[model samples]
Target: MKYILDFDIAAVCISCITLFLFYERKQRRFGPGESYGRIAWTVLLSSVFSAASSYFANALPGTSGAATMATVTLFYLFHNSIAFFAAVYILNYGGLLPVKKTMRVLLALPWAIAIAAVASNPITRLISYVDSANVYRRGPLFFILYLLSTLYFLIIIAALFFKRSHYRKSHQRAFLAAALAPVLAALIQGFNRGLMLECFGASVSALLALITIQNASELMDGQSGLYHRESFIEFLAGAFKKKEPFTVLIAHSPELADLQGSLEMQNYRALVAQVSKWMFQASGAGAAPSWVGTGVFGLLFSRRLKSNPVGDLALKILDLADASWSVGSLHVKVPFKVTILQCPEDAADISDVVDCIDQIAEVARHSAHKKIYTKFDFSVGKHKRSSAVAAALERCLERESPELFYQPVYSIARSKPFALEVLLGLSLVNNEQAFQSEVLSTAEKMGVSRQLTELTLKKAFEWHAANKQELAGIDQLQLRLVSSMCLDLDWPRTVLKTAADARMDLSKVCFEITETTVSRFGNDLAMNMELLTGKGVSFALDDFGSGYTNLVKLAPMPFSIIKFDKKIIQPGLQSNKGRQLLEGMVDIFKRRECAVAAEGVETEAQAGMLALMNFDHLQGYLFGKPMSGQRIVEALKNG
Candidate 1:
């Protein structure tokens, strides 16, 4: 009874190493995605135990009796358990498992029966055998164990492949590839008995799953050896959870296509690979560079290795990125721009930081300047960053640094602008193009949104009165109100008073309410809305197609205008099914005597499509970008 090195022992060693590494990596997972880790670890442990027990079945002690019988039968039991539970893991990961815990347990009944049979096999001698020669091997009944595992693996592979849309593509590929290993190995081994393929095959597949999913993580991006967008977000989310502050410098390559177009695809790929490596090297040793888009790179730096106010750092990184790419004397200067956002300064949280960066990117895309830095333009810059932003917004609202600009909503039936939406202008610190929603959100979070709204409306009324003679051609002035603000039970009175006090007509104003605000407010808001409608204050459902809306929800509400959200409308204009859906909505609204408007109509094609669908109004950059009150007055005077 000398111990020997065999395939099973080798398999056990490999599985043990994989599990050890897996548990080590498991220490870092946070919040979500922890469930996937639990599933993977469970599958690994079951596979490990299965491999461990198989060792004794491949060998025998010089003595044979109950000890041999016990050891051999345990192997069959572990193998049976592996077969049953591996399928369970697959079903669970694929989200095909039963909802009820009792049903799930019932589903495991067949595996339990197989385990019981193996347990009683010492007398039954069904799956395991200790022959007269004192050597142990799998009996004819053991083939059933392989059959079960094979069947399950095939089913799992087929399920994942066929239902590919249900899963993340990365996860689907990994599971499909991993599931193929053991089943394929079983088939190969069925042809040749001497090949110890199943043990190593299963171990390698498990390791593949671990590396592809649980381990590769934020540290690596597949084979590129660079961080990806998801990794950057994951890493930053973890950092934010720990209250760790940092700056993100995003660089977008505007001329990446031009550079790639000049070269062969393979050479361009190689050039990008070199550029990625250069980015990592240039972004300071402590900084992490992630490929956020095909032509964009993001460098994340913590306080330990960087300074606050990352404008200078962003310029430096851009300098590094925009330099000439010398590939065998073919130098290509990449035209790019960098957008810098400091956390807890520009944004209070990770979500806000993401939003700020997105807005900055939008500005950068439209900006004619080669370089732009986000620094405060207001005198309140000396204050704390978050406070300064909030104060700057308040000051912007009160003083009308930019003021309420008007974007005319073109009426298709009239073939002219019948109304103009009063969009709040942003000319705060840095003269940045601030998102209205974000600014108002900051105001709301700071308990000043109500005051801000009042200030904005008051300004709008003042401008409307001064230009009332000039703006007589324009029929209505649309203003936006959040559900909370709209349903405050006093907004209806405030609307009438504000207009009356300014000597501006309340009959000419239409208030747009966001769907999210409406859905969140329930019946109380509907009652308040009806009160406004009764007073001749026309209401528009803003961003209609963005949220869950149906006749049941929309019928009770008092709405005179239905403004289609850009996202749902844009696609509907492109596809027949989507167009039909939009047509149905337009028809329903038309029947209800509601004027249908489409928001974010940026193209002639979009305007034409919506016009053909009998939409009444179109609002977007296509008609006119939101302009200062002076600009609107000038346009009116000139005409």
Candidate 2:
């Protein structure tokens, strides 16, 4: 009885201390619940009851079996009640249990039943016995019932401990150890004279003390580290859930292969690790640096830290690392750029933060300067314009927003519009600005240029199909083909099949290929052109004089028409060298039985000069700027 009193007091003291420490860690790890102080109060109340039951059982004086039965029953009920609550706590803290009324009811059921049974007269007597010295000893059935209850409680605690271990975050192992200590101790005490349980509890206390010391050492070393992704996500979610402003700075290294080639591979990795360490130190006293990918690091901090602090921190770290990278023999010294997106400033979701950073990284890659960081700027007019253009293009698939514009290609000898050059005009929605020329470049970078070109061609075909009479009047309608589109075998094959399905005349469609497209795509050009020409579609060389154009390059290719670049024609009317080059190009095309067209003539003089040089077509502002099909028909009527 004397030892029982000591054991009860010690158990109560240890329980209170552990619970207090657990809660303190929980607050630092996870914030308060919606009920504010309710969780802590409930846990404290359960501990008090457990402590009280232990005290009363030790203090009770009676050899009467009925009184001993009553004491053991109360103690068992109190212990089980706390066990149930601890299970619920672990599940909730691990994020396995949802915070709902139904979940709360389910978690509270075991505790409620235990409380009711302890208060009931019949069950209490059935569960306990009194020994000869007025001491409480469990009955034969008591051992069985206690074993089952203990096993069940230990199973719950063990399940939670293992489940949480997989997370492997800071303090998770220590928390698991703390939760497991009492369960292991109780299992030992059930067989032995409570000696092992007491020793285990003391050992756990020592281990916890050691952990605290290690944490303090890490803190002194300026390392507040998190080892898993879930912890980072939970941390961010907590900050965002509370509507607290924060910033997420994502630093992406150049591709590892790219970096590896720049310097010795080992040296590069060492440099990266050093930079990562520096980033954590610079971010804050408690910043956790996470390596999200081989070359990507994520640092999350409170927005109240400073104004544009991520940018400043990134620059400072880069400067200190002194990253001098060499690719082959070329020495390139630069800092890694940091892209920052603010929480509740840029987006509410973590996924959106990731996407915004990805877009910023893409923009940074194309930017010319090195070591320059970019923040997500929703107000950038250029980005808005590009988005509007992409949206308008999407709408074009459903409605006729894109119209066909035609430029007349006149026959100098015939003095008539022999061929029509089809141009694409996108109808802007509302006050939406059209895409700049770089929009096409952007699409190419996004791997959608071929699709955009095919869409344009399809729109042209749809227009031609609707206006058979206008198309029939023209000797030929020339459509400018993007070189990239020709290189796409699947797209070109699809276009051919579509044209065949529509019963469109391939002879009426003259595809003008830019010289650069031919140069870039090379032999694929020759092969695709040969297939289309075999299908009775004529091909012309567009932008002839520009883009590394050489006679040697043009001699072996099959082209029905040769169009002089605007650069050659614009100055040829006044410059002798330009005039000679224009005449020479025309003569060469004539000898090859290819018609020649002069582009960009703006005056009657330029037009007359082109006509005199035996150009088969005169295409420029002098005749008319590219206009809609209806306007072209009206021009034809007026002329």
lDDT of 1 by residue, 430-530 (tens): 65555576667777777777777777778888888888888888988888886557547667788778778888776787888888877777687788777
The model with the greatest TM-score is: 2
TM-score of candidate 1 relative to the true fold: 0.42
Tens-place lDDT digits, model 2, residues 59-79: 656334564454445555545
Cα RMSD to native, each candidate?
A: 20.9, 11.4
In model 1, which residue pairs have backbone atoms overlapping below 3 Å? 377-429
Report the error of model 2 at residue 445, Å.
Answer: 6.5
The TM-scores of all predictions, comma-separated, are: 0.42, 0.52
lDDT accuracy of residue 613 in candidate 2: 86
